[model samples]
Target: MIDDAGSTLTAELSAYHPLWHLKRINWLEGFGASVPEDEPITTRVFLIDTGVHVGHPYLSKAIDAQLAIDFSALPFGLRYVDGINKPIEFDPEILDHLPLSANDKATISQLMQRASGKLCKAPLETALHTAFPSHGTACAGLIGARMPGFFTDPLPSLTDGKPALAVPYWGVDPLSTIIPVSTSLNPTPGQLILALVYALQNQADVIHLPRGISVAWMSDNGEYDNPGLSLKTDQDEAEWEALEALLFAISRTVPIVCAAGNSGENSLAYPANLSLEDKGENGIISVGALSSAGFRSSYSNYGPGLTVVAPSDDATVFNRYQIRINELGRRYRLHDYAGYVGAGLPRVDFSREAILSTDIPGQNGYTGYSPLGYDEDDDTFAHANDPLQGAFTLFGGTSAASSIVAGVVALMTRRAKMKGQILSGPQLKQILRATARGTPADTKADDINGDKASLELLFGSGLVDAGKAVGKIGA
Candidate 1:
């Protein structure tokens, strides 16, 4: 019902590959869910965004790259500086939507009609910003293919042999050994509360944000005290009171996942509105989106300070939803628009689409580096392209759903170091809210808040079942 013209809906869609267009020894014999090489599954994960392509080839040995962490020392120009920059397009009438393969629906409807005419734009280059491995090099090749020693170069090499899917930018800096600190722009709750007080005096476990604030720094006046106003007006309470003192000074000790925003409404997203009441810092979780049939996500952004939920993979209706509950079971409803497609609202690209991960390089041609003035390493600068391959890519928001839930919380800290019981940050968020995945059934209740408080506003402790959060961190 939606093909009025645009070349008959760009002749039915698909055709837009730039994450290096494919070459990493033939893209790891098909990406995503496949891990068995004697059961690998490493885990490091830092991805502060606007940087990471730490030598692609699916994730060059799992990227540590000799401490190269760059919290904006320069690069990160845009391409979504790391999360929710806007895309949406697909309302060609929704007969159950999900189609786009004709080269990703004529390259995402010619990049949303060239971003609605201004020649296309909005925070795009993913994989948490840049260094090049596009899509954070396929999400660090899905966490070095399921978390064992979390690669950066343990075995990956096969041009004429076999093991393809690449990785190798060993410079290093997965949070500069744990947060030394640097700066350029895009961060100012007094530098995210001085990098959460240098990552809680250094024993850092997680902080990742994949971009989720700047809609012109929110608060179009919702009562924030209007200094200028545009985000809608209320001045958004002085940036939510300096993000509630940087979320009670870094959830008391690391743990932060932000990104339940791509302008998806139901309001209350900033630092998950500093978790409304438990003002005692429980260690912040706040994810949203869910789609691969898990439900919820009509652009995610509900209330009661949302706690969890995942998979955000909508990619223009490609599917992935999450946070279930229906058939009189209850709990559903989350919309900005339901039927009539076009105005059927919901944004964060309907909870991100075609996900995948890891990919950086929005700029990387360094050599004559310059922190403030300039130094050496010339050859007209501009390096970053070694054995990493196109790195990896695929897009959508909540900034790749907060680095796929911080790479499943670094695979639950490598399954709590194979079980010795040392899990921190409020005991890994009380074992991810006592093993989430509940739903009572509200079947998208009029899209969200027309009843049942839109099921706790919008899936607070409902979805996020990454194999039951990796089987409750492997029991």
Candidate 2:
């Protein structure tokens, strides 16, 4: 249950995401079967969201700075532009998302042949709409935080050079390169289509869209409701129709992971709900947020289309490091709430609980910068006294969960490369469904909207099993 009293439950002196907080990282080693591979092929994950700060050491160290692009700028037609407004190095081998004429390929080849390394701007700066990397950077870090071997392989930890529990675990695959494309927080349907088109042409292995467009709807009382998803009436068919075609085209190329919104209802959000029917199954994978206690998050939306769940708040029974899934799994230890702790119904404290990640520099939310949000202190709730408050902050939503799954997708691809396995988009979804861990059976089904069948309303297939998904490639 969320505490309306506005009390702080968990705080600390540093800014980090402990492995305990992100229990999914531990699944890289096959959940209890095999250990992490010695060396895996590096893959690329395309982040389609708020722009990221490419200079951040944490993300920069793990990614190729050359692959970053910003789409929230002028000339939205061609593709996601660089900070200086130049075209990305087009290689036919990696880029097959868009069908290009032979002449087009020849022209690109000529440009690359005459390319100069110093094409960057004199004074580096991205457009206002695209420069802020707050949300996108955070998601990129979770997928591949530039730490030591710790990020690539999860295990025991030592905080500040001392043995400490709840060690801030980093990315699922630190070696994966990130292609940062700045799609706005609230982009028009036109802008959304362009971003999708770019992802396909650019050779993105796994694409993560952490935001959704909620169309207004009318309630039973004849009153228009707030911005929520209305399948039939929300945003005209013409608007979403063009984008859905692009979505179908892209889904066939790469796995697109989208968030299931944070509205705390049983509604379906667009883009997140964009699925291509193949073999009588939906191709889009929607991710919901999970609490640290291994239960469905109270603020997470639940309904018919959820594909899997991941952690958002790090204060539940699932986050405890030493605890294994044995006979002792019956009793769970919750961090903030001590009330009635049961199996899957782990209660979460929204205020004091969150996933720490990279924040926009000098924004109103973080100290060193001016206000970015309407209120300068919008992010103070997450980063109160951290020495590097301006660089890192905390956030908890389906956005974070979506990125977590995207990171695992990178790991899955890496495992596939080593084992000479080639699994398509549909195959990956089946592996996730077969291997995922089920959520608490106590929560009631989401029958809010009529005529919707649900295996588990709160969580679709179940909690994402990172290790099992990767292991399936070799099997």
Candidate 3:
């Protein structure tokens, strides 16, 4: 559907399937020389997650390193903090399962000694010390991996030589900038709130959180929203109001894109579900995942308050994530690259189910998993782990989906900015809903059902159509 002079193509992409999403959104069609230089400055996306690896070639190219902040060090004793609900202390038992070699473990302890006197401590000896691996960077990559040549334009329609045809260039907004805030290795409610303020103060147009904040009582009836909620009071109704207020403030200015969680239930994840009413009018996007084949992912959360769907996987192709056969003849999902598992992470053969992006050089896998050797693709692992310099690894979940939407928002905002218009957060949400097409209705568990609008509960306004959204700007 290249309606313009071969500049853009509209194809339904597999979420963050930059190659896919870009074509579906017809991204390049709007790329005009008339855009001002400061458009990117006004359209920054702040990803509040694990913090980016800041080293992947594609991400490194796309992100603003100057805007990156590592809050993992700010919230003391949070090296292994995952969430307030899943509280993690620096447990001695974790010592036994650390994904490091003996020498690397010793090296971490020694590095700690050297960092003790420093103003801020070292990030981590490796990904081993972290509760999660590649969380922030993977999200960042999804938001801005224009990507390396392979990912940006994966499937190119060829010429039978009748006439020279052009396949539109594909990828997220290459011009957009990302401001990464690494809340913690494990983020608490306090850390999340702080991250929100920091991102807004720094002038982010979009705020993307990859995970769901577990709420004790947010089933569409709870009315507590304060912006001053603390770690100790995270579960308190009083504290939740504070959290909601913070979300409300951020959404008023910057569109807050959040994952709808992966429980596969009909429940909605908050902040994404942070509306006084259910249609999510407070500038929150409760993104659900669609497999590449245009069906609701079995693992994606649904029901009331959900905003839109994006492709993380395709049902017909994989029923989970959209898999791609790479140039190396290796089968993998897009952006979810193959790479090595460094120290301080749980070891498992992660090649089959993760999104690959920039990593802290020589990072580890997830925590508590046994160390693994190559099961099938030795060369892919070898290349990924070579001196562990590539700084690439895999990650997944609604976090990736949320960031993908954030990327689209960035594109929309940037496009609008160039046209002498500014899209407020609420307006952004409205545009997405108005422009979106219908997606597969929920039929997974057979009984998980509800209705928030005219459409089926699970799919929201359907899959987010980025091309249509941009087209609606100023209209």
Candidate 4:
């Protein structure tokens, strides 16, 4: 956790690492502001995406499990109001279809029992089987995973007697609360609308949508046009209208931080694109990703709707490293290596540049401990015998960037409440835009369909300046 001295347990970690992304955005400077002690307000950030692994040690304290809602349990095409009235029931028979062990099924049943009602519960084993179990968990961790005070086993540090790794990890806003809302990987328009409604009812201070919907149809010139303008069917048009209405209502109060898709195109996905139409204060905050080298991330989508950019993995730097130690049997024991070197042990580098966050524990999640030996070329590393093997992994994309922005918003909200003032969604958005730093020097304007665009068109206002934004809250 961040203390008064502004130093964390993972402070001595490597300079060339994933955590550097936080420093790039001046996160610590922003966190230094004083919040009112007599009247504290809990900033609740509603994370609408694949359910989080609430049981993860790093995220256990940050998440509010009782308020978590799983819309995936509701049948498709179910109306938003009906889902609220209906109780979500997990069917045991569905587990039978999955190729899981009997023990896994039993554990899932236990989790289901605990998750009954509005309480959100995501079984680690079940999530591991999904396409991306770490998706929501990683995003949540980026927003508010608490820094553990103690470790079960000491981690391997590059320096002798100093406990540090390739990167130290923690949430951007550890004091904020996260409300995990579970949904299918590709949720329908109705399901997304339902999630937004749930967040609004819960009085969420900030809503982070790590995913995006492309409601706009592509034109013959290879550009995404306005939403609901080229819909082919009445049903599609109706769904778009419903989504717009809900967004319009929510934007008036709560800031909806959205990822500017990963399509690498010049167009933003729906809702994120809505930022373009949002001239008011309370509106969508579209976030794009910036590479480690201070440039717009190659995969991040950019256009007029982008509100700001944040530091994210550029897929160039390697964040994952494996080292062999002599103390094989001792748990979490790092050998006192001579100097900072690991006594000439064979080290492995596998993972690429990405944000580090909590993942599903054990071998089920990404960075699983594989027994078949290490494959340096593969993204997943074999931590079978490593003492530093914990519930953490490297993740990237505009989604990660969006989560970081949401965390900043949470901090700003807390700061506002501390000052005995309430900043509306639009006020916060305006502050962020006003305080944002200029775009990176490497960022260049792009020509979209023979039309020259300015840097603002590509990177929105500019990079998000957390310190400036937080300091300006209530001013």
Candidate 5:
């Protein structure tokens, strides 16, 4: 089915675009900034997203072939390629219809039902059908690539009025294995422990979790101080303790990166801030968001726990639009702003305005669904088409921020792999933080508490200089 044009979404999404401000940064004037093809570092990033679409042009280049191996051991029906997985037969509405045997699907479904709270889960079948246009897919696009062999032929022969599947020139195997978990997966205390164990069993180098205790444990009252929302409370303390224990255990193996959270509040999001307590270790990276203006977006939660900031598009206007409502209920559209993007916002800071990366081939259910129209309040409307800019639209949230940081971690790891340097997680975090550049003296400061501060909590480490980070590769 044809989808809405991205141009409209792009127009609406301009303000929220994370790199919106990067466009404003005078990279030419920067002391060390240069748009060079090669950097001191180029690493392999393992993107943990819903699934990536193999058909998009951008991802075709980043797929790492050397690591590709057949993982038919995973459900046999699933196919991989094109920097995305090929769609399979499954109904979007049916959450439990894997072609695997009844017992098998049941087992997987049950596992996901329990774990769904932490991982961003969706039907693998749905991801394939839509070509994965969800937040997870967009994340993968920001990292690695897809190989051409996955696409046997661009022009497959048509049969029964349907295009034939492309044939691969070489036998394709799984690259950077994916262990799918539900986006809604909320792990029980026991389950969280088990899953962490499983992830470690798989030797996952870095675990990217989108949600944590703070946002997950909030209450209906909507107060941050309430024990319900605070991680220190009785209901959440156990979970927090378990997560911390797991983090400590896992840090011994792989580093963990979490989104700082999208809540525009005074405190740092839990777990993200928790990791920042200086464990004297390298197992955690807490990332914040930076706007295109090279400043922190207004909405991102910020505080001391922040390790660094990345290109998490602070806002996607296409995702959320606010309409003004009067006392009489008369309503009119003001400006539709993307959460983090605006004039003077942080830009991608690269020569190419768009960060050239992977793209999902089809629609994941989130976008392209029939629009979620105005709510009872009439103050907002979420046009399904309006929620996305392209199959590869821009989005922001600690979710995007988390993945961006993970990608950088991957690249750093890869660079180290090449240089024969063996650095641990604590070491990496220190290097990244130490190399960070500060905000300029004349740069506009954040208006917090009726006064401006040179170093605001939101955009930590100033603007992330990937080039500088790369330059500091060996250091």
Candidate 6:
């Protein structure tokens, strides 16, 4: 079932793309059913994560570069001022300009100091080496990537065995504007709060936090365990309380969608877990990942706070060489690989599925440029060049799932705006929950609790159905 390299058995490349998920959520049908209009209302979804590549072909049309902000430059920690050491503070003029309470400002200053200490001990830049540099680009593409116009000829399907030409990679709400807010690779609570405030100020219709924060303590077994919401320090409490207040305020006007986390634990990460608290009509919408099989993904965190599930990758193995060759043959028409023989081709394990979205262009990001020497069998080195190889990649996790939900929310916002109505965050959540479909039969039912309660714990309301949500909003 698995090879020594951990690569899964190979299957057709179509199985790893997002079209299957798109169809399952009824994306096309829902938008197709909407009333025809000369001009559809444009909505904005603020994405706070690693910076996006604004120049990517699929994302260039949707990104609003003028409104984008790089918050990674925010200073944190102590600094000597006039030979006197003091906590680094925001300029008095700038502090006065903000609409925050005095207490919140003080807490922010304290957080900045704490974040600085953490950075000093272990810089986040080192961690970025193994991390996805194009994380923000991937998330943004899921929300608003427009279809590229390069493919004049029909390409092989990227979803299933259907004979019809596969649709090119596109996002749920291609017309929606993306407000990119760049933060540190691992953002601290203060940075996240500041980003939220910025998004609010910019009039973002929906906010997508495709990352999570966790507060953990070392156990007796010398392992760290998360203590959700039960913060140990006064500073931690103050920061979370402030964040909760801001989220509540924002939710009154626009929906905030957050990832449930990638750790396969029974409890959710912080902020996302905050959704469990009773916020009475308005709260953060926590999203979990669903495998192509319609079951909870093995790596997706679960809990009562989870608001809904969305399709994502669920493979245990990845054969990079095979994936690249398949893409080149199918999409780029570079099919002269001597290494790719009939039945001898490598197989991927666990039915290897992934979400196909935009990536950072060039060899810097995932799906690196050209797969020429990666495989040993290909002697035809001269014919192995693919110019657009790095433009797209297969990405997954609750991050991708949350982006899908955010895009759906954007579509709903546009639909409501077209009908001359403004739906509150709570109203949008209500519509999504009411219209969600049930979990698949293959979903694990081992929870001691009854089926309905257990399903809610694992999948929140259920799988997010875009068509139903949009139709409800329009009605």
| Strongest candidate by lDDT | 4
TM-score of each: 0.28, 0.67, 0.64, 0.72, 0.56, 0.70
Distance (Å) between predicted and true CA of 301, model 6? 0.9
Scored by lDDT, model 6 comes in at 0.65
Worst 10 residues of 3 by lDDT: 161-170
lDDT of each: 0.42, 0.56, 0.54, 0.66, 0.44, 0.65
User: Across residues 1-475, which tens digit of lDDT does each residue of candidate 5 receive?
Assistant: 0023223323322433333422232211121221122443333343333334433443435543223222211332123334443322222223232123454334333443443222222233433564333554555554333334432433222222332322111101112223432221223343444444444544455566655443443446644432222334553444544445556656544667777777755567756776665664546777776654454554566777677776544332122222111222212234333333454443322111123222332333334423243332235443334322233443456665566566555555554555667766676676667756665631234543332444646566654545455456655
C-alpha lDDT (0 to 100) for residue 277 of candidate 4: 62
lDDT (Cα, tens digit) per residue for candidate 4, span 177-291: 9988876666645556667666766778999999886554434654543432452664444545656656755776789999998876788887788887644444689999876
Residue-wise lDDT of candidate 6 within 33-122, one digit each (tens)?
Answer: 432356657688999886677767677778886666555543321111123223323333333444457787677555544432111111
Which regions of candidate 3 fall more than 4 Å away from where they truly are?
1-18, 24-42, 73-133, 146-171, 217-238, 275-280, 314-395, 439-455
| Candidate 5, residue 98: lDDT | 16
Sort the predicted structures by lDDT, highest score first.
Answer: 4, 6, 2, 3, 5, 1
Where model 4 places Cα greater than 4 Å from the true spot, the runs are: 1-3, 7-16, 34-40, 73-125, 150-167, 216-236, 278-281, 315-352, 362-390, 439-453
The numbered model that scores best in TM-score is 4
Q: Compared with the true structure, what per-residue lDDT tens digits does model 3 show for residues 1-475? A: 2233243222223222325544443445543331345424446888877655554456666676555555455433223222222222222332243233464334333322332211122233443344343566667766776434422333343323221212222235556777776665444455565566556556777888887776545557655333334333434443345456557655766788889888766777766666335434478778987655444665677777788877674211222223222323333433344442132332211112333444444334321222322324224342232334434444456776677788788878877777778777888898888877773332222222322324547677777777678767755
TM-score of structure candidate 2? 0.67
The positional error of residue 433 in candidate 1, measured at the CA in angstroms, is 14
Across 1-475, the per-residue lDDT of candidate 2 in tens digits comes to 1121112111221223345444443443532222234653667788877566666556666655565554444333113334555654434453244344454434334434443222222213442223345667678777777643343223323434532222233566666778776644555554555555556666677888887764332236544333223335434334445455556555655788888987767754666765425323434678888766555565577777678887785322223211122122122222322332354442233223467666554563222344322222222243343344355656667888888888777777777667777666666667777777774532223322232436466777788888678777788
lDDT of 1 at 355: 48
Candidate 5: segments with Cα more than 4 A from true spot? 1-124, 128-133, 146-192, 212-240, 278-282, 314-366, 369-390, 441-444, 448-456
lDDT of 3 at 70: 50
Better of 1 and 5 by lDDT: 5
